[model samples]
Target chain A: MKRAFIPLLILGALAVVSAWLALSFGSVNTPWQTVWQVISGNERGLPFDLVLQLRLPRAINAFTTGALLALAGALMQVLLRNPLADPYVLGISGGAAVAALCALLLGIGGLWLNAAAFAGALISMLIVFGLARGAGAWSASRLLLTGVIVASGWGAVIGFLLTVSPDAQLRGMLFWLMGDLGSATQYGVGVVTLVLGLGLSLPLARNLNVMARGELTARALGVPVARLRLGLYVLASLLTAVAVMTAGSIGFIGLVAPHVLRLAVGNDHRILLPGAALFGGSLLLLADTVARTALAPQQLPVGVVTALLGVPVFLYLLSRAERR
Target chain B: MSVQIPIIETRDLNLSIADKAICRNLNLRVNPTERWGLLGVNGVGKTSLLLALAGLKIPQAGSVHLQGRALSELSGRQIAQICGVMFQDSDDAFPVSVLETALIGRHPYLHAWAWESAADEAIARAALQAVNLSDCAHRMTNSLSGGERRRLALAALLAQDPTLMLLDEPVNHLDLHHQIDVLELLTQQVAQHGKAAVMVLHDVNLAMRYCDHVMMLFGYGEVLQGPVQEVLTLDNLSRLYGHPVRSVETPEGCLFYPGKT
Candidate 1:
């Protein structure tokens, strides 16, 4: 407990550096000192406009989205007690994607699209929760199976929508399906959701640690297992909803961030949750930065960048952990 | 002398699974400083009975009381303050340290946001010492062998320090020496601290040597409960398992084994 903070502090520094990089580099690069001057209110014009107005909000949204997804992933893993569990594995992103695509098909854009996606995510969450509970005892595997099947159903709907849509809408729908952050101009909802999630979950860190062992063991150790599980499902689903609304269906970070951190820092959630948030936020910011700049004006989806960067790192960590 | 209140009591408890009956209208009282052993054949619901007693399972009929309060009336946290349970198997699906696992004993006593204190750490350390895992505190649970993991489970239960302990197959993976050592440790704790324990065990002789009282479950909801000397006999042992039993008196006590193949 005493030394847990050192890793978090380093992750914090990494987050700061990633944010700075996001501010400085893009299709048109801004040098570090000029970017600093623009941010510090000492300069005006294109640099200031680009730094503060354009890139700043997008960068904040990227960090918030990544943090939300990663923390949600960590909680989801604990809630399911499965190492493979991720924020999107339960169909939250698929639901959001189906709704967002439907909204786009109706020519809806901006805030209404986000609202439709959020409503879709919540509805999917409730459906999975109700069906997984069923008539028998509630078990993690039951929930996982229910979520996976529901996600597939939503995938079919998304495919149908994409097939019937016009050529003009097809490209946009594909970008959203692949997860794009270019349209994100507001950070308020995502930031607040991430903060509230971390605040509420940190207090339950010890309970989550016990929960990761098994439901029966958790119940034996005095945790109100049913109630805690309900809370986790709701929290993780909402975090994923906010992330999907902020970006589209950003992957890899949700599945890989917590896992990589668990290998690096062990599985004490007190450190793992906050550490996941920081590391995940940083990783996504850097990924997005590379996404917009690497192709130089023909931006690859941020989700593509995340998977391209995350897979190798995650496999390396898993192999190293097994060796120990 | 003051009258003693049983640490745990069950009134007219009926337990069953599907169509199979475990026990019927069973009344039981376990006092402090007593160690009770539950003996039965396979599929007789010894583990289920232990769960029912620990409030982890609801009895099909009747009620279970902890220190006079109905088990249903108390919160899980409140029940945990008075009782701790040790399950038969240990599953470490994720990585956790030995000391960290033992500190889980203090979980029921902690506030939601609080970390385990120095005092809690000391208690965990003492518990590991009692289980002979003191030097392995920092080791991950996945690295521990079966016997070591079972001992670690026991250590966690000791750290819980509840008045009543309900253990299911507490000696499942242990060797002869460690089995006796763990049972003797439980005996000493019960005697010295006025705590109580109810165990589900397979070995009748170990049960005979350690428990002051015994409960035997025969098929079809029939049960026998009383002082060990009065209830654990050659006939009851034979009837309990549906096999003939033989016993030889020794300096330590009477030991029973199968009479014929």
Candidate 2:
């Protein structure tokens, strides 16, 4: 227990540093002293507005979104008992992408688009859940297979929506599809959901550890496997929905963050869940900071930077794990 | 004899897989300080019957009772407190240390928000030591050999420390020495702790040497059960396995093998 704390504390420190860097370095490049003054409420005017109104909320949204995705990814992997399972593996993101694209074609923007994406995610979850639970016994492989097939169906719809839409809206649609934290203004819901997801999942962490072994073993060892699987599916899907609604369909963090942390902390979900959240939130915050500043006035989608940064780290961890 | 309540009892229990009948009208009682061996042919629903006994599978007819209460009335945690099952294979979907895996045995006893106490860790360590896995406690489960993995499963069950244990092919993948070692450990647990065990075994010789009671299931719901001496006759053994069997008496016990045509 004591050993698990060290890595988590380090990740928490990284999260703070990442948030500070995100607030300080941007298009205007505010000085650290001014940033600190604004944070401590000792300053006023444009720097204060820029720090408090503009960057702080965006940073919170980015961190919360990243935390949600990573937590969802960890849950999906455990529930399905597959390392390849990600937050989007069950078609939740694909469904949101399709709905958000449709809303885009219909001249919808802002909050309505978020709502549509969330509805689509829930619909997709239900369909996959119902189909996977089909006339036979439910299994992880069956759920995964159903989810994969449904995601492909959603992909075709998204493609059709993109091709048929007006040429003028193409760039915005593409940015959203590729994941844009630029328009994220509502960080409150995302923050709440991240906290709730982490809080609820932590108590079930030991059951999740047993579940990683197998459903049969879990049941034998006193875990109510059926109920736990259902709860996990719902929780992970809700987390993915909130993430997509907050920042379109940010990729890589959901898949890679948990994997990297599993190497550092082992597979104990008690530590892995929160650790992935911190590590993933920090990584995305840092990635978003780079996305905003690296190209000057032109911003790269946060997804691109996430993959760019995450792949090398994930590969390094994998190689190190192999050597060990 | 004083009438001590059986740890696990099945009343008129019927178990089947698809069209195959594993057992029918089976009324079996496993008392404390007893080790019962379940013997049958491959794919004859031995595993299914074991699962039913463990309250993991619902019987096709009738019911099972644990500690004088209906098994259906118990929760998963409640059943786990009384019964521990060791599966044939250890599913390692993610990497975890051997000691962590053993610590899972204390899961049923702890509250949702509670961590394992120091005494619980001691129990886990003692279990590992019993299985000769103390040196490998910190090693990852994936690093263990097949025999070592088998021992780890046993260690986890030992840490669970239930009154009744249901083991499916406990000796599978084990070397000869480790197999005997594991069975000896189980026997000692049952005798010294007043525990009960129902294990499925393919090796008739080992069952003869270790188990005091035997239950033989023939497909189509046929079964013969009694004290090991009365139930382990050459005729019943051959009929149970659908093959001719020959036995030779030894100082230890009677050893049975296939008859030469």
User: For model 2, what is the error of residue A1's alpha carbon versus the real structure, in angstroms, after optimal superposition?
Assistant: 3.1
Listed for each candidate, the true contacts retained, as a fraction, are 0.68, 0.79
Candidate 2 at A86: error in angstroms? 0.8
After superposing candidate 1 on the true structure, give the runs of residues whose Cα lies further than 4 Å from its correct spot.
none
Per residue, candidate 1 scores C-alpha lDDT tens digits across A1-324 of 675779899999999999999999987789999988997789998989898998999899999999999999999999888876899999999999999999999999999999999999999999998899887678888899999999999999998999999999999899998899999888999988999999999999989988876777788777999899999999999999999998999989998989888877888999999999998899999999999899888999999999888888878877887899
Across B1-261, the per-residue lDDT of candidate 1 in tens digits comes to 788889999999999988799999999999999999999999999988988998888778999999999999998888888999998887777878999999989989998888899999999999999999999999999999999998999999999999998988899999999999999999999999999999999999999999999999997999999999999999999889899999998998788999886
> Using alpha carbons, what is the TM-score of model 2?
0.99
Write down the lDDT of every candidate, Cα atoms only: 0.92, 0.91
Q: Is the docking of candidate 1 incorrect, acceptable, medium or high quality?
A: medium
In model 1, residue pairs whose N, Cα or C atoms come closer than 3 Å (at least 3 residues apart or on different chains), thus clashing, are none
Index of the highest-TM-score prediction: 2
